[model samples]
Target: MAVVEGLLLQATSTGLLLGALVLLLVYYLSSSFSFKEEDNEPPGPKPLPLLGNLLQLDLKQPHESLCELAKTYGSVFKVYFGPKKVVVLAGYKTVKQALVNHAEEFGEREIGKLFKNLSEEHGILFSNGENWREMRRFALTNLRDFGMGKRGSEEKIVEEIQYIVEEFGKFEGKAFDTTQPVNNAVSNIISSIVYGSRFEYSDPQFKEMVNRANENVRIGGSAPIRLYNVFPWIGPFLKSKRKLERNTEKNRKEINGIISSLQETLHPDDRRGFIDSFLVRKQSDEKSGQKNSRFNDKNLLSTVLNLFVAGTDTTGTTLRWGLLLMAKNPHIQDRVHEEIDRVIGGRQVVVEDRKNLPYTDAVIHEIQRCANIVPMSLPHVTSCDVHFNGFFIKKGTTVYPLLTSVLRDESEWESPQTFNPDHFLDKQGRFAKKDAFMPFSAGRRVCLGESLARMELFLFFTSLLQHFRFTPPPGVSKDQLDLTPVSGITLNPSPHKLCAVKRS
Candidate 1:
């Protein structure tokens, strides 16, 4: 008994000593490392030691915290994520100046190990330099050539919308979760562009890919993901992190399998899917001896995969929010239904219908503005050392602009925190564009699928609202409309149940 007590005492003594040493070390580091608290640097909360302002940060809802910090630090300020300096641009004007006015200086994308590993510096989203330019050009050209922005694109979108409405109608009088069907509709639209066809909702591979994509997205902004980014060596120890990577690999394999099958069946002459067009470009480039051709199969696969990831959850989640918002504010839902009835009159509503439906358009814009999915865009890198608005953002530093803050800036909006569609409407009841509104971000690094995404949201929202009125389950009050977003790389609403009551 004496021996055991002696061992316990020694262990306790060692722990206390170690704790004291850590405290002393931290104090020393905090004092030694100089973070200039000058007027020039962007504003933020007081940072401490090696942890910086990490403890004060709310990883789940970073936008709210950023807005609070912006209040003290001003619209623009600097904060450190450990030893690294990150310049955060808050509010509309600051964001505009940094991302738009100084676009060239900040055009570089941040290439961390994980993003590079996933994209291999091949796809447009994470790739930079020569590869990015080449791929971006190709993607834009093909997207345009295949009718992305033109009326032809609208026809395709309307066709998909029709199919989606029909699918939703199957749940005619039943209360079914619309997430999968909405996701399928959005994915099919993009798939039509990429693969020239859409997969069945029941396809095992398609379902698996969607599941994996959802998992990866959900893991984003999680403590483990942030931890891994901060200390890469710790990644292997976290099983969830490993699971995320494994799942990503599995998803990639499934997507690649589809691409491989297409390659086998489609001859060089047949320019059907995006891959076919890419293969043709590859052959031409090979003949011309183009330097570092980026149109190869690997890039094609990664680009399509990126599309699947970016397109699926965002649109589906937005629809989910739309339904919830309508349910919570039945007045808004009735207004939408009235507009559809008055405008369409039992006829098909197309993308062109938005121009005629001011109330509906305002509501859709409000939803995007309020929800603000990708609040802080994928971090951008400083191409070279540059000084703007007082601070020197060093070369290779990551710049995370709180985009949602800009959208919801109280200085700009009347009811910044509330769901007011009037923010996008003028006194004339016409749609008015707000300079502060940038849900899809701005400048060169903005969402590549911005046009398509906008079209999809408009078509889906209008189509669904025209058919059915959304409501919470019986006995549930309107206040129960879940607005709590799940903290991930993308801000998703918490799981909630909704019933799509038929308009008739």
Candidate 2:
């Protein structure tokens, strides 16, 4: 008993000494590293040592919390995530000026430890400098050629929309979860682009891959991920962080499998898909003795993963929001149907129909505005020391361009808090363009698949609405439906069912 007590006392003393050392370290760092109010730093709530305003912010729905902060701090201010201080640019004007007027200064994407873990420090999404420049240029050129944001893309989308329309018909007017089918259909568009093929709806591999991808996105916004980004060495002990690491690895493996198959059958003369084009470019680079080329196998695989994941989730989740919102607001849905009937009755609705169906276009824009799927965009970094709005942001400071602020800025929208299609409509009911309509985001690093997503959203949304009237499940009133989103890096709807009643 005496021996045990002695051992316990020694261990307790050691723990106490270690804790004191940590406290001393924290105190030193907080005083030395923290920005002072007189430093011309963006004004914000006073941050606590080590915690750094973490308690003041919501981990789950940070944008909502950040919106509240903007009320107190104004459009441009500093907010710390952990010990890291991030300058948040809110409202349309502020964001536009920073991302547009000062593009070069805010062009670099901040690669947090978790993001590095996901991308393996390769890929366009997280890379910087010459690598990012080369990858972005290569990707944009090839994607445009393949049909992204072009007339050729519309044909691909229309083809895919037909399958989804048929799939909706299968429900035969009964309530069902449209999540899987919608995700599968939307993801397949990306699949067709990247891998040159789409998967069967019931394909187990396809379903698992998507589920894992979504999980990674969910994880990206989890507290564990935030912690991992701050303290990467602690990641091994966090299950969520571990799971995210595994998901990225698994995603890379799956993409590599597809790339390997494509490589074997890749014809030098004919570019079947993005992968083929990349392979052809890689070979050309090798032949030209461009030894330090970025078109290697690792880059190709990482980029494919990047495109597939980014393309699938943002657009898929937005489509889901569109259907749910329509169900909740039948009058708006009726108006949409009326416009479709008046504009493209007895014929397939195409992207061009958007110009004619003004109300429908307005509804789509309103849906995106309300959905605000990606509330806080991926963190950006200051490429150089920037002096803006009387604030001195150091070079390489992590910055967050909060989209939620712009999407729902009171100054910009007539009914920012309410779901009103009139937000996108003029007095004449013509579809009006809003500088604040940045669902695909804006400026240099705007979503790469913006054109593809727009085509998909219009075609799929119109086609589905044409074939079926979405509604709350039987016995569930529309008022009872929840529009509250599951907060993460992106906002997603909670799991719920809606009826897809066949239209006459």
Candidate 3:
């Protein structure tokens, strides 16, 4: 009877211990969830605890949602994506001031879980401090030697244009989707530099890589990916986010194979392409006491992949938008054709011709501004605590320089909502550069391929426009052509066939 009583006492003690533990857990959780920005922080819509503004934000197009909030909160405001707090700089002046005037303060790349998973901070795109500076300088110098923005590079683009023209001839002036052919042509220009060779459109390997790139972009920019970023612990349960991880690995492996082959054939004197150049640098560094250890194989792979991906999507989408907008706005199309015919003539158009074709340049700029491909710029981090534009932004605060807000700021453009080439044209009808025309972004983190992209867009757009006039397929009216992008991180025009009637 005494043993039984002792056992009962022990059970009572266990129950009290469990109860106390439960109370402790509740208190910790309650205290931990109390998230609030400092009093000196910018004012914004009040965010809920833990969830922050996730539910309130339109994750698909966070830029648009933020724009709506700016109407209430002003140019500079704070937002919470889950528990993570971000300060958004809206409109042209504010974004410019932060990215340009305060460049050093806001220079760091604000990497998220998804970006870290893909890059692991090895390449120029997601790196900071010494790594970014070294890689960017190397990339720019090499690209210049390879004829990036110069007349020497013009030959490579012109050669690629021939391939596109030949493929367009296969369409026989019938309605064909220009998406793949255009993508192939533009991508080959970069491939010739990266892989030292170009792939045929029929090549399965090339097609697979392009498909994977497009898919990765879609998934990476999706709502679920953002959710995974906000709540990284929940990544295991999200299928879309998991697919992104697999996609990242697949791209890395493919690039690695090409890099391996390049290594086998590399000669110090005969540097054929980017891989050869990088390998030569890596060897030089190894012998020089590792002064520049950033020139390793890992960085080579990541940088190559980043360049390959960057080279493909951004310019290709803009060109596609150019064609769609032209098809939709026939009057604009007619003006471009006239301008090209008068300035460039029927013979093969070149990058040099962009200067003479003012109307065409204006039209191209308008299309980019209207399409706004990269609506939300890549996230950036503050280098140190910054009191920017009347708000106390702490050190390492994530900053969203809303490119869409600047591109579509109501005060900056007379008709920001409408597709008007006049925005880029002076009252005298000359090509005029606007302070707000920042499609390539501003400051230090501007795309390394800006010059290359500019040349490609000019050469490809002119080449295609010189040869054929784009018109909507079948009964589709000009106004009916959907300008709204097929949703992704970048804006892609809806897949629609256009009749490329041969120019007489």
Question: What's each prediction's clash count?
Answer: 6, 0, 0
Whole-model lDDT values for every prediction: 0.76, 0.83, 0.83
* Model 1 quality (TM-score): 0.90
Tens-digit lDDT string for candidate 1 (221-256): 665566456545444445557777888789778878
Q: What's the true lDDT of residue 171 in model 1?
A: 72
lDDT of 1: 0.76
Stretch of 10 with least lDDT, candidate 3? 8-17
Candidate 2 per-residue C-alpha lDDT over 1-504 given as tens digits, one digit per residue, 9 for 90 to 100? 344323323333233223333543655664656644436788889887665777787667778889999999998898876578889999999998989999999989999887776566688888888888889898999888888878877877888888888888888888888888898899998888777788888888889899888888887887556655764544444567667778878888887888888889999788888999999999999999997889998889888888988888989999999999999999999999998888888788778888998888888888899999988888899999999887888888888899999999999999899889998888998989998998877778898888888888888988888888999998999999899898767788888899888888
1-504, model 3: which lDDT tens digit per residue? 334323322323233223323433554575767675576899888877666776677776788889999999999999998679999999999999999999999989999898887788988888999998998899888877777788766898898888898898888878899888888887888887877778899998787777777777777777666766776654554567767777778888888888888899988887778878999989888888876499987788888888888888889889999998899899999999999988878798887777788899999899889989888788999999999887899998899999999999888899999999999888888999899999988999998999989889988998899998999887878878887676576778877888888898
Query: Which sections of candidate 3 miss by over 4 Å?
Result: 1-32
